[model samples]
Target: MFIEPDYKYMPTTTGISLPSPKGSRFVASCIALTCVLCFVLPSGYSYGSALLCLTCIPLLLWFRPALSLTREDLWILSALVFYVIAHFVIIQYHGSASRYFEEPSRFLLGIFVFLAVIGFKPSERSWWLGLAIGTILGGMVALWQLLQTDLPRAQGFMNAIQFGNLCLLMGCMCLAGLGWAHQQACPRRWVWLLILAAVMGLAASFFSGARGGWVALPFLLGLLYLCFRHRMQRRFLLIGLTLMTALVVTLYLIPQTGVQLRIEQMSSGLGGYMQGTHVDQSIGVRLEMWRAALAVASEKPWMGWGETGYVEPLVQLISDAASRTQVAELDHLHNDILDTLVKRGALGVIALLAVYLMPLIVFARVSLRASPEDYRLRAFSLCGLLLVTGVIMFGFTQAFLRHNSGVTLFAFFMVVLWGYVRLAEPKVHSE
Candidate 1:
């Protein structure tokens, strides 16, 4: 009697062969260099970086011509293209195309570079390892900055918020690395490196004093706990519990440290709310800004005033009500949703939501369908958790989506998610 061949035992090549360890090292170096350029290089590098990213696209295509696009990838690309067109329409009708042209094209280019990287099919595991190495470098830079400063001054290549955001992303990467390392066929040394990376990332976040990071940290931690509650090793669970307890204790005990200071600084803006003095002068400013935005929105509810269009109008509106000194020199609205609403109007908001929510939807679907035995699924789940936390925290006090650091990190994670989803999908068998 002849027995059927074991289907599960068949050896198959990964879609993209794992690049050699040296190649992984080179990729890691590139990631670190990109981070440094984005953070430390002067603002003028924005255009140059876009050019460099454009140069990478054809290189990736040449390297992996067999790359096939998935339905999910198509959805993401379509959403992005639609948003670009929508932005141009709004700029043509209500705003200056020149202002919109300056930053948006670079963001779109960054997205292209990111997707190209994802498409390159380097060993699925190598991408996580590379990201972990990049996170280690970023963490070290942040820690060095913290050591050099006595007060909460922005250091390194980015602003305080951006630094904090990087720390937050690094922390997430570290967690994913830990999961990846555990599942790898590598020796003990790689595990040690991942453990070191995770600790360093957490420490960097503690030192950065970014209030937005403070808000995001717990959410990510909670997500990890929920995801791993059932299948994690007992020692791992114990370590996680201890870390959570220590974090809580630290939060209660350390009143003047890290994120606490930033929170206090923001609260200072609300000082008048607590004391009766200058209540109208303090909290009144943001309130007035919100009211002015609403008034503008009512006037052009469909098309919006366009990018930066609200500045002159907002300045004029505030100058009329109070002393020149009282009016805040406004940038984008402090609120992300409100900023989008003012800049893009109703259609812009829909576009913004599509950009933000698509990843969450995609990640959730992937996580639900992922195999219990697959390590890539765990990494994807961890990334999804971090993205959710970052989005919620950013909603409170940041317009991260509009800023360079935020946009770059967002694009990077999008590519990571795309790569993991591709790796997770079951391949078709050919007879």
Candidate 2:
């Protein structure tokens, strides 16, 4: 019901200046509230995002917010369509048909959230500010968990790995917010608060002993360097780097922390797996699972084993009852690439690639052409790239997309940023 705008048109200013309907702000506030709940609720908050998405459909239908699509959007949308179709194919192949009704609904809800962002054009500052606050609160909860437990790892609200991954993402967003604040020459205390929030989020990840997020940190830092080196003064960069190094060194020196021990275990496990002597530990089990996945994939290279098909075959390949049990319990292959290859086959791989890479290409391109004044977009592009990097890295040891949090976070941010990018038009004077 909304009027269509030129594909390339967007607001030139930092935020959109549309004359939204009287009730649009109310709906926007509801979305914001959902975001806060998503952050504060330790577990099952992905459903909160889904709920937000469901609400968007009726709002979009009633208000008819402006909508535009770009080439990148088309690529992403096409991938989603193909993925849904692939599930239908799986049903034809007599795979688990119930999954068709289950998982895709979450993704479809994500699509609604995407459309709602474009249509509503909610306040950028409010959205991000609320997210920042929620992130800080989440980080505090993680710290509290660490203090309350005698366990080696702390996972507040979610599992250790997911919590760690979330902290890393929140850390990245804080860095981008810091950069945006600096660009605007905001008060020093405001910048300090952003830095504090980033530090706390990162520290929580370390406390959680989540190796997956740590694996992505180097690349994340590199991205930040590239994003900030040209934008800020040299002294600030040097100071930030020094402080980061000091923090790492401090964490390393702490005797109670399991980071060093975990690294040693990973190395030993990998070495034993390579030497063909041990196949019982964590890393060893992952290797075994991967090997079995590869075999299953080769057998059904084109269309894959379907939702429920891969399990029994993989279990048969594993000789040890314990190992077989472990394999059976795993919902999907730990690796996203492998899981897609097994379930959706080669076509699913292409679709999955499209979903991940299209955003990278689109955001990177937008960032390159962005002027110094476009701090909001620049920060957002970097945040998107960093978030995607973290998720992909996490996927190496886990089926990230198979998880609700993974689906919700990735889809929500992608849409939020792209929606604004679409709405960003060169400022036009009214006659």
Candidate 3:
């Protein structure tokens, strides 16, 4: 579907250089488009990523070897490609049509986007500001949804869980941006602006009432602390925690936000789960799903049952009819590990683990370059770490990779964040 543009040689022929000033700016706009529209509109984030991915074809054909791509980045691209191939093999083994190809295929396509970002080296400012602006606008959309409709959750254009989790993740990226913003001309104003974006993003998350997303909060705070502990003062940490506590309490007290009701619902579910009474509920159903997944996987260890093949056994394994019915109605197991383990076994385990771990490793290694003076590199590294950590933690309660939005956001954001960190510090990738 991509036409080879006639202007492919324009940057080279006109006394221009690779990674020219104009090229950087153009790439910056492309990144900005990706972040700014990430959650504000329906699948809007993909627009920019599509352009970036499309750019990869020509780059691969023409400039593959001379490019500045590093060994570590290729590690990530290879892992993503492996995921797609692994999933495709699973599909072929199951004899299913390519109906299940979309999700993992996202990771494959993301490799192209990663190549484009690395080759072009998009503006880091564009990345952070675009993230903040997108979260701000997305929060507004969620607010409008809350006030104008009777829906219990403000999902915007996505499922409430995906919408809320992504908003929270981008907001965390805004928090990570503070490190870089300090070096800017208007540091104080930019700091406050990023803080506001963070608040708005959290607000949107609360409004969506996505309790599964809430599971990642402690892990989020932990990662933030690890990344910023040396950079941030103890008082600032205390103050931030105090403010967060106050914010959660305030949101809980507000009836329209549905925060309190959601908490109460979870509490009741847990209590009923303890007494073995409400087997039909969300928490109970998830527990049953996990148990069923484990049971089925034990029967076929290497490559477990196919998607459709596992359901009958899953239903048979569950004792509660209500829980069985609930589980049967769904495609995923509501847990990423269990779903992957039950369906694709060793191949999937490797792919899923790589999808989470390679980026984590790459960012962790790159973040080591954040010396006291280099806040820009530090900021991008922290953002990448925080984003991946959020995805990993969020997967515990949701089969996040099962959703198109989840796959799109994770794949594109990983590349953009990693690319920015590497571009900002050229030596980080080599080290």
Q: Quick one: best lDDT, which candidate?
A: 3
> Could you give candidate 3's per-residue lDDT for residues 100-120 as a string of tens digits?
888887787777776666666
Q: Worst 10-residue stretch by lDDT in candidate 1?
A: 1-10
Q: Candidate 2: lDDT of 210?
A: 80
RMSD for all candidates, in order, please.
6.7, 4.9, 4.1
Q: Candidate 3 overall Cα lDDT vs. reference?
A: 0.80
Q: Compare candidates 2 and 3 on TM-score and give the better one.
A: 3
Q: What is the C-alpha lDDT of each candidate?
A: 0.60, 0.70, 0.80
Question: In what order do the candidates fall by lDDT, top score first?
Answer: 3, 2, 1
Q: Cα RMSD (Å) between model 1 and the true structure?
A: 6.7
Error of 1 at 365 (Å): 0.4
Q: Is candidate 1 or candidate 3 better by TM-score?
A: 3
Candidate 3 has what TM-score? 0.92
Q: Who is ahead in TM-score, 1 or 2?
A: 2
